[model samples]
Target: MLGRVNHIAIAVPILEEAAAIYRDTLGAKVSEPQSLPKHGVTVIFVELPNTKIELLEPLDDASPIAAFLERNPSGGIHHICYETPDILSAAEKLSAAGARILGDGKPKIGAHGKPVLFLHPKDFNGTLIELEEV
Candidate 1:
């Protein structure tokens, strides 16, 4: 049901600073910041040879990233996304297998403008898993 690793998401206290580290220090190609209101995050993607790294900053105080930042002021890895050929089928299978889906248990438009769904971290060894339709 899963394809290759899509992108690993990191929640940061400040987006610009994080992007600068990846761009200036690591010499990576970082994409322009894009606000995802639905997800309550402003993101910038660091282009890598094999996979991309998604840097997320909270859009507002109520944003989930804001809550994450509160727990870890320095910020940290938030989630790992995996590509899926068919998200609906994958969601169905995962549900049947007793894996809880986050939110309304429906796919949402992700950073790549593709259908995506998040699975409960408890079901995935304490790591939030994002399934994005490729």
Candidate 2:
């Protein structure tokens, strides 16, 4: 089962500009850019009091974020991550419940170096959902 909201991800055409909005304008504490080549994204985290905002930009044309940006030039919320006590069990439960998991249906190392799985957007009200093991 899902736990607390981990972070809210927003895809941006330009990571720097997007990060600036949160860091400069909003006066937030933003982390340095971290390139996740395996995930094909470069991310920056905006630290929040209760949660975090993840800024995602495509690492290359083949990146999923690139496709998302193509469809949404202005960029927007890409996904919402929720924590889980056990990802494998969570995946199995969601799978048995008929929710489709993305990719190979296996957990991958996320930005926080924690195991994570992505559920299909169609299964979650058109919003991509990421489950991260806590």
Candidate with top lDDT is: 1
The C-alpha stretches of model 2 lying farther than 4 A from their native spots are: none
Error of 1 at 57 (Å): 0.5
Poorest stretch of ten by lDDT in candidate 1: 104-113
* Superposition error at 100 for model 2 (Å): 0.5
How many clashes in each structure?
0, 0
Residue-wise C-alpha lDDT for candidate 2, range 1-45, written one tens digit per residue: 878999999999999999999989999999999998988999999
Worst 10 residues of 2 by lDDT: 103-112
In model 1, how large is the Cα lDDT of residue 41? 93
Please report, in order, the local distance difference test score of every candidate based on alpha carbons.
Answer: 0.94, 0.93
TM-score of each: 0.95, 0.95
lDDT of 1 by residue, 1-134 (tens): 98988899999999999999999998999999999898799999999999999999999999988988999999999999999999999989999999999999989887679999999999999999999999
